[model samples]
Target: MLSTAFALFCFLLAADCLETHVHGDLFVPDAILRISAQNISIGGIQRYTTLVNGSVPGPELRVSEGKVVWIRVYNDMTDRNTTMHWHGLAQAASPFSDGTPLASQWPIPPQHFFDYELQIPNDTAGTYFYHSHVGFQSVSASGSLIVEDRSNPPYKYDDERTITLQELFNLTDVDVEQRITADPLLWFGENNGFLVNGKTISDYGVIDNSTATLAVIEVDPGKTYRLRFIAATALSYTSFAFESHDGLEVIEADGHYTKPLSTDLMQMGSGQRFSVLLKTKSCDELEQSGRLDYYLQVETRERSAVATNYALLRYRDTCNLPESSVHHLPTDSYPSKKPIDLPPTISGFLDYQLQPLVPNNFPTTSQVTRRIVLNVQQFEDGYYVWRDSNVSWSDASIDSRRYTTPATPYLVSLYTNQTAYLPKYDAAIANGGVDPTTQTFPAKLGEVLEIVLQNIGSISKTNVTPGLLETHPWHAHGGHYYDLGGGPGAWSSEAMEARLQGTLPVLRDTTMLFRYNEATQPDVKSGWRAWRLRVQNPGVWMIHCHWLQHMIQGMQTVWVFGDAGDILKVPRREVEGFLTFGGDVYGNGTHVPERVHFSEGG
Candidate 1:
């Protein structure tokens, strides 16, 4: 039912190649991270996990646009060895501070610490945060990593609210892991209902008679407010709308600026961040009678059983409210016009499918390159007495042994002066041997090209229906980029070239939804696993799954770019290895590590 090689990687992420102590600005723990759990009731019952420093939601670490910051994380949690990755941070370009264990740096030995430094870019702004980037950032392991406006924020809100939308549960790691691992019915696409900041539906055990399922944001009706919303769900795209409000202007997404798109409903996926200027009315006008009475709401509409808020928008200028206004003067720099109407139809539009959005095609100069198939899977493993559902989070003990049901990020690390490899169809490619798909491209200087994505999963067919291709949103660090086009999985080199000549797709520095199933099928959504981008930007760029846990579990890699003059020569290890093996004598990857012993396939 499974290949031995894959199974080996799963159980043990490969023995270390080098035994070395790492030092730098990375987040290496100074001591063991202490995380405690308590089972509580809201609608029913749930367990809330909190990190050390004693906050259910961890402390917020603020950095500026241009600075070199060092993070030293000491893993204090018991049971398993761990590491932290800076999800969405530009890693490929930023190498040392990438934060990915094993791939970019060494895994922090249990009871030990590791460190590295991140050269935060000068232009970084908007709202972006960081978490364990190790696993399940959707759970309790993450917190906001905000790069504030070096100059005071232009808005004048009474208070600043950084709300992270995530799910929580009462079960232990063992409890949840045992069920999902044992039962195939509880497969890849599952949602555990719990909110770290928001309340639960069915009154789950956390809430009783007094509290509501909303995180309140108070404001005066006259002044505009800035609400930076971050959604960190494993598989949920959320929307926010207001009934008794003027309008909301979207200024940023995924921590980067975008062509200002105004809308009441702010939509985003995991790893995506959005900010809106909530233009509120004045406080005095409300003192007489109609106070700023409002509601705040979130729904798991992506899946069937959705949740609504008891206090959707309950805000007023009461004595209990915090200072909502900032001392900085508010500026009316970007005037708000009538909101853009959502498109009603695309009936006759000529569709060439989609292609990658890098300027020009590929590149004439690529110093280092690599192609990876983000293989995702759903197995038909349990056919006997095992059948479990009504899935909830696991109990504490299960946390350590837990692995994922779906396919996680298969790493493809590249170094300067190395020839990247791409695999072809039918035949799966490993480190070297022969790449069914291989290419050589050029890397230019001073340009920071954002990468576009496509699906890269195994093709699984049902007897009667089409196969499934898992789609994940492609996330970048340092900055966000415009999204052009993404091809259907069927595209090869030839057709992709033709589609590039058409009109450009929309530019989005924010997080844009990537679709695996057709739009009409709401229950099924995913993004391309196979995508490409130009490494014009300098520094390390981290590319990984938006599902933070997947990234921590090894669904991550790094890219490095240096000045054109400093660029190293291509390492022809693949050419050398392939030639050495002779044809027909198979090998795994071109850059074969010197450790493995192999010969021609007898």
Candidate 2:
């Protein structure tokens, strides 16, 4: 159901609009994404949902490395505002295009289009993705963004394939959102099924002959293929395992090449990506075994009923067909490889072992200019809500009408020299601390920051057993950082630096903070994760949990890099119409603002 009529024409336009630059050439209007509400079916379950180009998971976009491209996104939905977030791409110079609503820029209202200028750094060449950053639309509105290597890559492969993993929600996004945010919190942790490239067999405790198509990745025998995976799930920690294949060499993680490491099992949380080289079996061996297809089993690792999904990895010569197509359910006998029983701790296996291919000159503890310690906790003020330390990120204290999604974006107020509308915060709070009034963290331009996120058992307003702990996948908006790893009880900087032994850490834009409780680790009561980065990108960036339910409950805050003047340094043409109410700053009158700016800034 995806529309592809404008592919060839878009490429031609990109070629003709190139302008030479220092890093590479810049292409204007490289591609156009049209978002609309469509009636689509996934795994035989139909739902009226929002989609990009009328597809559940949007199309894969492949571009050469070290290139800048302008992508135009149009929202055609009748009643929803949206924004696009490039998951791993570092918007170094164009910070406003980071695509976080209210923090980076205003959300693109319905029936309007916005142009996003994406600059892929020369060093960033691997797997990544783009998704909606507002509300729960990311569940259905997302796609893979691949930056292919212009020259010869480090690893050789005969072919390549992309697999996007997700969780299926049978209800409408609005209904689901209301349930999660309802006073009674009727939305318990229950999902319909798991997805592999938007296809799966419906095994929700029923025996129905639904011939749903499974994603088929055909490969020639005795050839190696690079399998790129993006975890676009809203609330699932997925684990993948090959039925009869082993020795998958992981070469890339989060758009950065890693030292080659072989593993039989691969695990990923939301907003994460990786690349693995899979070598197919020989033709003679496959013929002898009387099997030309294998199953790639995917399982959800959350604390619930483990939903299983399957995808077919077929050989090229299967059934003597020209090309092997999708494998439907109930046709062939299922593979013997079922989902493995793995502990939650095993999910962090690759985080510590996979080192960066390019060594980094790590900074010593003495060089760190600031350190931030944040505690993750859950409370029940009226309904259940998650928070960082003591406060959650809602603007109800300032403006009750616009609680989470502000009527006036903080960036717009800063640009127009209107500070009264924005949240009040003390930037001189020594070491750049969090301001509960504004729910923002302020940092200088060139300071090196070390952030520690500590997770503790849930605290509530009632007397009951503490809620079970869950793995929280934290993601950053502006750029990537060095992952220094996680711990059991509490975070200790001295201990972490000593353990490094003057070695560099793996670079990533998103990582997981493990949870601890009486059941998991009796000796330890809390868990923690540490990361380090240089505060170079000048703009308002958001740091939040990738899980949609938690994010909606206010488990997020914004980081203001540099001052208002620094962010205003961005070219006026890039953010002209976006900072105002009409969305006509780009000299075109297409966009419409959904809400009025009640503050004086507008």
Candidate 3:
């Protein structure tokens, strides 16, 4: 009897050990990140802001396409709540991990933890990024998320580099938010300087200083390098180019591979990414001719307030030279000068025709099932508040009527079949105090929805000389859309049809809604941008302006697909786990109030 009992115990222990080993091999995270607030210096001034790990712009996370990635984010922030959004990622059935605060999930409060298990779908692999989505925290807590295609890429490149372009301000995120609340006309905070991979060139001299270390990309003479450019700014629209380098072939935009279109300059809005191929000349030949270095220049376009920033692209052996031996181009020769002075038009060279690398059977415009017009305008009570389709997007606010006892998120309401705050399209026009029913736009599953984002200037103040015309970079979650061509001002069906011209549109996740110019022509109307989205993802998706300030002041909305039946298709355990595990524990049921608040009238 004793010998039989011992055998049974050994069998049970072996089974348990085997199970543990198998689970560990399958479920271990590819990368673990810690989100915290840290003081970092920029442009010679030190300021405190949220950061991932210990770096501003965080760390680059790379995962193979179609692989399951387990990411554990530990929030070490003491005061602020935080959530990291996987920008441009189609979370598909995993809506709970979408990371929009009060939409998909709650903020991972101080000393809390959240584990995100993301499966990068084989079909949807491209350049994306992760950043804080809670309030103004994303101003610093951002990083690149690259999904590399496991199969051989169609484009030819010998090497690759990631370039992150961001705008920095002297004020803290809280202070910036306060200023914007006081005066909505501030838009995004005043841009102190621009940065390339978290560093800037010295302001005073041609010498490279320790304080201002330019991000360097080393290259061999005879090899082609793939440059992945991410415009991760909170506000600014940038024009990017490499000085004295003309053959920049843009092969990918927003993760979709496109036909190679060579251009001297590329324009990127906030949350957009582009991959360009740069072929280097023979280093021996260039050295023989005395040209050894070049600058990758990025500058704010369509606005005069931001400064230009540059990174060095040094030849492999050129670092032996003195640090002061830097090459500076003439101010007039910069790419920013051309785009700023030229009329706003899509260049076949820059905005080339993009088609999917593996062409799937997608419906054309004629097959679209629904059409929605999103009119972008400013609503003024005392301060400027942006509205879409006359509905200012509502969230759980202290002063708003939508605030609930448990602080229900907009997405949680949809998942739980709670319709108390679901906004109706028509009622949102006049209803004021945080009515969710007015702000929500509903759709059906697998429906092809066409959204025409029309920007007709603001009512409060003119941001630029050409009226209330301001650029808005619109981003959609949970899906990629086909970017149909846009035009100036209100688009009629006929105009849209003409713009399509019976061709397939480029697939992208973020698109810039350009501002209209009266000076271009007297008959020009306010600017408009159009995109066709297939509502394949069932979860409530947040669509908003990537301009962080605009999104804060109600320039956002949600697209609800199907009904409770469709929402229930998601794993019940995932929904419950998110509601129970995610959220601010310190505030209990109530939300922590912002440092600044607008007056009731404002």
Candidate closest to the true structure, highest TM-score: 2
> Candidate 1: lDDT of 73?
55
- Flag the better candidate by lDDT, 1 or 2: 2
C-alpha TM-scores of all predictions? 0.61, 0.86, 0.82
**What is the TM-score of candidate 1?**
0.61
lDDT (Cα atoms) of all candidates against the true structure: 0.41, 0.72, 0.67
User: In candidate 3, what are the lDDT values of residues 361-382, reduced to their tens digit?
Assistant: 5678678876777877755444
Candidate 2, number of clashes: 1
Candidate 1's error at 435, in angstroms? 5.4
lDDT tens string, model 1, 1-602?
A: 23466447445854322211223224233222333333444433444443534454556677777665655555554444345555545644334345544333333433443333455666566676655543442366566777877876544455566767766544443344344444332333344453535444433443343332344455645556667877766655554456556457666555554444456555556776767777765554444434445444444444434443323344455433334431211111111321223222122111222222233243321422444333332223241011011011111122323322211111222332234422231232242212223211123444434343433332223231233333344465433443444444443445444554654432333333244343322112244322344445544344444643333333333333443233322222322221221111111223112211111101
lDDT of model 1 at residue 514?
A: 44
**lDDT at residue 150 of model 2 (Cα atoms):** 79
For model 1, give the 10-residue run with minimal summed lDDT.
383-392
Task: TM-score for candidate 2, please give it.
Answer: 0.86
